[model samples]
Target: MPTVRSVTDATFVDQVLLADGLVLVDFWAAWCKPCRAMAPVVEQFAAANRSRITVVKLNVDENRETSETYGITTIPTLRAFRGGREVASIVGALPRKALETRLRGVLGRGAAQGPID
Candidate 1:
């Protein structure tokens, strides 16, 4: 099953920013084909990394404020946050292996142990 949850502008701060550990926010809209195609990939990644990260989805069309704040000009943007700040971001749909690799590269080792390096 997919472990990803949805967050809105009203909940973005408490859910993603003030959140503990690492949080991966998927900024996407329903109409975007790439975003839809990436859903399963993201869900699988989330399930596999459940112990290390918290995954959530935010629809750009529904939450414009948060999207604008994050300077998201494109869809399917995946952002990783740690210590209430963005530590990494990927701006397009990627395969599971690539996604994991990219995130691991940016987050580095001991990612779940503490703040992102």
Candidate 2:
């Protein structure tokens, strides 16, 4: 199943910014409780929206440049990019429904479930 993948500063451009469609990036750290809490939801969302979106994770500790460039002052920051441009962002821990709502809003209609790649 398609799921979240780990990304680093070096690969941020090609893996995210230059990607074709919607890409949800989870900027997190190992020690962050909220980030850990949201992991599974992100995975499930990725699996469900495999065709519409690509999900990825970036560890702040390991990728300082990317984090700093994005001005990620908080862990668990979820940034959504579409067509090589950042479109939305969310910070902190949120429930599954709320996360889904946010993603749906960003995705803008067309509710269909497809197996992730």
Which window of 10 residues has the lowest lDDT sum in candidate 2?
108-117
Question: Considering every candidate listed, which one attains the maximal lDDT?
Answer: 1
lDDT of each: 0.88, 0.85
Q: Clashes per prediction?
A: 0, 0
Q: For every model shown, what is its TM-score relative to the native structure?
A: 0.90, 0.88
Worst lDDT run of 10 residues, candidate 1, spans 108-117
Candidate 1 Cα errors over 4 Å, as ranges: 106-117
TM-score of 2: 0.88
lDDT per residue for candidate 1 within 2-115, as digits (tens), equals 599999999999999999778999999999999999999999999998988999999999999999999999989999988777788889998999999888854454434443
- After superposition, the stretches of candidate 2 with alpha carbons farther than 4 Å from their true spots are 109-117
